[model samples]
Target: MQQSIMSTLPLLLLLLFSSLFPAPSHAWGIHGHLIVCQIAQGRLSDAAAAAVRGLLPSYAGGNLSSLCSWADGVKLRYPWSAPLHYIDTPDHLCSYTYDRDCKDEDSFRGRCVAGAINNYTSQLLTYDATSPSTQYNLTQALLFLAHFVGDIHQPLHVGFTSDKGGNTIDVHWYTRKTVLHHVWDDNIIKTAENDYYGEGVAEFVDALMQNITGEWSQRVPGWEECSKNQTTCPDTYASESIAAACDWAYKDVTEDSLLEDAYFGSRLPVVNLRLAQGGVRLAATLNRIFS
Candidate 1:
């Protein structure tokens, strides 16, 4: 009887844990849509197969029906959010320290780091590649690559030192309980939904891609500079935080209340430009590898 009860404790704890944060419906199939769209744009021969590889079970089992189905009504219309899976744990978020070391004592942190690196590498490859044989894989990979690239750019993804990436900072978002990470992930972009979903999102991401060309070209050197310039890191991180604060405030107040607009508007051009540059570079990478 004692043994049985002890065994049941683990099961009970699992059940309780599961209930605390129910898996969101929108979470799974997002990566598939981003991948499919990019591949379709490239028109790769094996685009269909590659796009479906990491799709959610629902999408893979034919419940979703189409790749575009995944994007029908996602949060914030930030397509990049799909491929960049959310790290629910605070430990995971804070693991991305300046030194590339993860203090988290779990496999999730390792997986997250590897996933991020792989995503980055894939984009670099796709941007440089042009060969037909490798183009298909590169093209398909580019979509996933692009989406993931955007995810890393989100300051919250890197996280703060003490707050565990905003998870610990609990606050109310329009009278509803929310945290800093959620605000960054959904709120800031949500405020821009009207503008972001339409031509605005495309334009914003495009401009960013252009501005980051030189920095991205020498991504290694860029990070080295970033390390030396630690002060810039906090400031850059604060910019994102302030944008998030203004976004949460927007829902209640007039549009003018959203000060993030000025910053977002000013910064969007650079974002879009960098994305375009990354995409092109990603293609170039694939060409070189297979050529």
Candidate 2:
């Protein structure tokens, strides 16, 4: 009995130590939570929805200025972000079929399985217009739908075989240990926590959207980029070590040097471009579902 107790003591102490140190923040939680709140507010009206969407670019430090503005700005008559024409049939879900090694861009069969999930949710929202469903309005359902679509656009969010969507790549941000996904989702955001998310993240996202909206402008080309870049995109991003990805993703902006650069200076324009697409798409989804 004494010997057994002695062995268990060390295990108990180790467990206690771990419990004392909470895991660092998860980026998905913060952003996803914010997305959910936006969708819920959108239920009011188009003006309400726009007002809600406005709040997103400015969310910060527990402030509600953006939220108040969004509530005021939503308009029922405003144009929806251009629909991804590729979503024509509404049955195709996977946008990155090419990411999985499918050679044909037109093949409906090769889309990433997650894209199917996206399509399904999108269809669900579309149909909700005529008839309503209780299960659909649940916070998780909204958050999952909103957040997953966002994830699909994040090049690294759909990781590779070796890294398993960056879950396997381990690295340290400051003194704490973290995986690649967590680093991208949380560490990067937390690193820039001081910048008012509404002002900073919103400004960054807005600029990205404006720049790409002028260039790509339409959802079809945006989807086409996903199709064309799928196979190479994941590997292209995974090509860097975990640390490099973090550094490249944030670079001069997240740090204190006050240096101004596109949020994605060292990386391919595709990442920021897609991020803008995802944000606008997310906003559009909210608009359509609530309109």
Residue 86 in candidate 2, Cα distance off native in Å: 21
Local accuracy of candidate 1 as per-residue lDDT tens digits, 1-291:
574355445434433453454344322123323322343234222432333332222223321123332222332344443323332223323233322432233433333322543544544334331232233333334333434333443444444435544556665544456665554455445444456555344443343343444445455233223244221132232234324333332224322233345544644443333233323433333323223
Tens-digit lDDT track of model 2 for 203-289:
544455456447666653443233352211222212222223334533332222222233323343444444555555455445445
For candidate 2, the per-residue lDDT at 238 reads 22
Most accurate candidate by lDDT: 2
The residue-level lDDT of candidate 2 at 207 comes to 50
TM-score of each: 0.39, 0.44
Best by TM-score: 2
Shift of residue 200 alpha carbon in model 2, Å? 4.6
lDDT of 1 at 42: 43
CA lDDT, every model vs. true structure: 0.37, 0.38
The 10-residue segment of model 2 with minimum total lDDT is 81-90
Instruction: Please state the error at residue 184 of candidate 2 in Å.
Output: 2.1
After superposition, the stretches of candidate 1 with alpha carbons farther than 4 Å from their true spots are 1-104, 107-110, 114-116, 119-147, 173-177, 195-291
lDDT of 1 at 112: 37
